[model samples]
Target chain A: MSRSTPLRGVHESLGATLTDFAGWQMPLRYGSESAEHNAVRTAAGLFDLSHMGEIFVVGAQAGEALDRALVGHLSVLAPGRARYTMIVNETGGILDDLIVYRLDEDQYMVVANASNYALVARELADRVRGYDARVTDRSDEYALVAVQGPRSAEILTALTDADLDDLKYYAIVPGVVAGTPALIARTGYTGEDGFELFVLNEHAVPLWNALAEAGKDAGLVPAGLSARDTLRLEAGMPLYGNELSAAITPFDAGLGRVVRFDKPGDFVGKAALERAAENGTRRRLVGLVARGRRVPRHGYPVTREGAVVGEVTSGAPSQSLGRPIAMAYVDEGALEKGSLAVDIRGSQEPVDVVDLPFYRRSK
Target chain B: MSTIPDDLSYTKEHEWVAGIEDGLTVTVGITAYAAEQLGDVVYVEVHSEVGSTVAAGDAVGEVESTKSVSDIFAPVGGEVVEINSAVVDNPSLVNSDPYGEGWLFRVRVEEEPEDLLSAAEYTALTSGES
Candidate 1:
């Protein structure tokens, strides 16, 4: 049986369609996914992201230990700030994409995807063994709730007197909401201004209800994993398994910028990453806008002149773009010179290779 | 529970047939249960051309949703007479009103297929599955 999040009862109460995702029974959507997707773009949407893993690294050498464990230099990241980074194997193969938040001088919290967090926690534990730091998996103790969209700040401010204005993008501030202690972060996967709330499991339901009541006038609807996926895709965010995997390196995904070789330490995959960077990758990730209504899906072969060139990673009917959009890894040369078409079923549907991020919210 | 009109016949594949009892002419569409399962319908394609004979249980068309896609099957052996152009333009009608405005095609039946379920049986089949 798949594990349930702390807010499973709340989802049941709302009659959500529950699906087993990454070993967790999570809500796919409460109602129409298009409405939820549009709500986040127009107003706001609430999310129960408790299924995400939270691993804490603390003690004197926590900073030093992380420098060797991951690609980004967490030690140099200012307190209350978070940076998107990756964990890699010895051959520079990506294990998972992570967001590490530096809470204090000797403390940091690493948020990882649900599918790969267990191994990530184990990797962090083993990598930090030589240092005077301790790695603890606090996933069971915490439940994450996110209020995402243009009206996220007002909805959150309605619940707490916390300084939402002081919080900049990618910054975290400790606050209390509905009498429940929470760490509010000004970050989200959706291409909109939003806040992610980290709170104890005991406070999950009450806090969700409180936010629902407070956000009623502000037009905040409960969103699910389906909307989250489409939102992230529109924002051009790479999911771990889809865009990053052990078989692929960061440079192959056009994410060489995430690796910080200048960080003052010998990190895992440093040498292999340097080699990969210098050699350059063969395939590059690109966005494909469908000329037809047929949506290209995962594992669909991208073709050039009736020959298989690459495969699609993630795809969806983009509500914002009003067309089908997909991410695919194609040969760099073919991407420039070759006229490409995705073999959707048996038909070769022509596509326009565009830049990443099919949608971006105006500030 | 999805509404299965007493006047319609249903397939285990989650399609609904109308006017089967009136004559050989009948309208076919996917049931609301299928539309609900498929989520938002973004693209739809019908295969059988006008005046073409299609065997019962043959794959005739396809409905593509945002997350997944399903094949639309012929309810009874018949010749395709007309297609619904409105649903072809706005596929969201499948979710909005699966039984009426979202009709896939009209078929002039060559022969009535056996073992098509009534409204009661279709409801019984889908109610448990959901």
Candidate 2:
């Protein structure tokens, strides 16, 4: 049996289509997924992200332990700030892409993907051994709700007095939302200005209702995993399983910047990452905009002149771009030499090589 | 619940058949339940073009949605008499009006269809699914 989030009943009441995602029964969409996708692009949308894992590391050596275990240099991250990072295996293959939030001087919260969080927690516990720190998986204790889009601030301002104006991007603040204590973070994967509220599991339904009520007039709709996937694809964000995998390195995915080789002391995969940085990658991630309406989906062969070069990682019909978009790892130098196409089933649908982030929010 | 028109006959593949008993030509479209399952339809391609012959259970066309793709099979052996170009241009009509504007094609029948389900039977089939 698949596990359900705290807001599963609420989603059922709203008539959401539920699907099993990463062993969790999550909302696929409330209604027309295109409507939900448009709502997030034009106005706002609320998301139930309780299935995401939250692992806490606390003690005097919390930052030090994280710096040794992960790719990013976490010791230098300021309090109440978050950084997008990743965890890699001994050979530099990405285990999971993570968001590390330095909640306080000696406390940090690591947010991981649902499918890989258990392994990530176990890895963290093992990596932090012999240090003055302890890793605890608190995923079951929390419920995450995100309000994302242009009018997210307007909807959140009415519910909380927590200076939304001062909450810069990638920053977190301790505040009360709808009379419940929560941690508010100004971060999102939708390429929109939004806040992620982390609260106890018991408060999930009430918080969802409160956000829905506050956002009713502001055109906030309940979005689900379908809309979320398209939105993040348009934003050019790499999903863990689809883009970054156990076989794909950060450098191969064009995310070599997340690897901090200059940090003090030896970290996991440091030597392998250094060699990868020096040798460069054979296949590089790039964006593809379909010239035709046929969607280039995951695992589809990306070809040049009928020769298979790489495969699509993530793809969807982008509401913001008004066409189908995809991210694929194509062999280097083949893109500049000739035109490329994605073999959708059997037909070679033409596509244009575009830059990452097919859509960017207007600031 | 998705609407299952009482007058139309349904295939186990989630397609509805109209005018199977009236004339040589019959209309075919995916059911609303199938459309809902596919999410927003982005592209529709009918492989069996007009004036083409097809056998029963032959894959005639395919519908591409945001998340999935499904094949549109021929309910009965027939000649493709007409294709819905409007749905080909604006595929969202498949989700908005699966029975009316989203009708995929009209096929002139060559043989009697076999094992097609009544509306009640289709409803029962879908009831077990959902």
Candidate 3:
């Protein structure tokens, strides 16, 4: 059976074309993918991200338990702050990339990808069984909505009592939005100024309606997964299944900044990461900007001459750049700072290996 | 809501063929349903050029959108007389006006196939019935 988000009916009512995404029936678009992408780039756009998994860890030893299970320094994270962390298996493969929110000293909320929820829950539960922490899966009980873009704050501030202006990036606050008690976080998948509201399933409809009404004056439209993918591509964020899988380590996937090897605590994959850091990974993720409008799609071979050196993990026409771009895992030898060619549909297109993020927000 | 003109014949894949001023030369483009499924076509790649012989189901072109890449199949076997260079430059024409300006190619049918569906039959094929 397919899963449905709390906002599934709302999406359908808006003429959204729905598709099976990560086992959930989610909207691919409402009208046009470009319009939705531009909405988030220029103004603000709402996203129903309720398909994401939310796991809560409570008990006196939550921090210590997570510290041993994940790779980030979670124990130092103060209340109201969130940190991006990763769970690796015993063999040092990534189990899931997640965000850990320190709700309190003894309570932490771990948000993971929907598809990997059960695996993550099982792994964390078995690991924490010996510790003093209790794991609870609250994914079905809560719904998540993200309001993203330049004018996101303007629209969100009007409906929520949360002092969003004071909330710095990656911070979370318990607040009320449209009269519903919620956790408003200053974070998003799209690399735009945004707020993610976590509310009860029952309050989802009213909260969505309220945001839609309040955001109308600000040009905020309901964006779906199509726009979400392009926006994140422009932002140079990695999707779990596409970019970061169990076969790819954080360092190999260009997420080295999120891994803190200097932290004074032992965590899963710590030793392997240290060794990999010293020896360097054999493959590195790089960005590919195709010369023409021909977008290099996933699974297309990345070739240097006639031989396949790598494969495209994700590719699309960048809504912000107005050109085709992609992320690919190339051999370390192919990571040379120069021009490379991506074999797209039997043709070799010259690509510039310039930088990771093809687009950046103006401060 | 756009009607597939009765004079035009269609394929199950949502391609429509209309006889040009020359009765032998038929212009082809995807139906509205095909355009809707492809979504915001940003690029088009026409591989077959003038004088290239193609089979009925042969892929002669590729249409790419932000989310997917769809193959433009030949509706009738014939030598390509002319490719629509305009649609190659601006594929959004396919989404905007799929029937007229967005026509993909004009082919001179070598052997007219009797298996082409009528406009009504094509409509039912896309609408998920017969």
TM-score of chain B of each: 0.96, 0.98, 0.91
- lDDT of residue A108 for candidate 1: 94
TM-score of each: 0.99, 0.99, 0.96
Query: Model 3: per-residue lDDT, tens digit, A161-227?
Result: 7898889999999999999999999989888999999999999999999999999989999998999
Tens-place lDDT per residue, model 1, A1-363, is 799999999999998889889999999999899999999999999999999999999999998899999998888889999999999999999999999998998999999999999999999999999899999999989999999999999899878878889999999978999889999899899989999999999999999999999998888999999999999999999988898899899999999998999889799999999999999978999999999999999999999999888999999999999999999999887887868999988999999999988999998
Q: Rank the candidate models, highest TM-score first.
A: 2, 1, 3
Off by over 4 Å in 2: none
**Top lDDT hit:** 2
Clashing pairs in 2: none
For candidate 1, write residues B18-114 as lDDT tens digits.
Answer: 9988777899999988988888898888978889999999999999987898898998998999999999999999999999999999999997789
Q: Cα lDDT for residue A323, model 3?
A: 86
- What docking class should model 1 receive? high
lDDT tens string, model 2, A148-215? 99999999999997998889999999999999899999999899999999999999989999999999
CA error at residue A337 for candidate 1, angstroms: 1.1
Report every candidate's CA lDDT: 0.92, 0.94, 0.87
Q: Which prediction has more favorable TM-score, 1 or 2?
A: 2
Off by over 4 Å in 3: B1-3, B20-22
Docking class of 2: high
Each model's DockQ? 0.84, 0.89, 0.89
DockQ of 3: 0.89
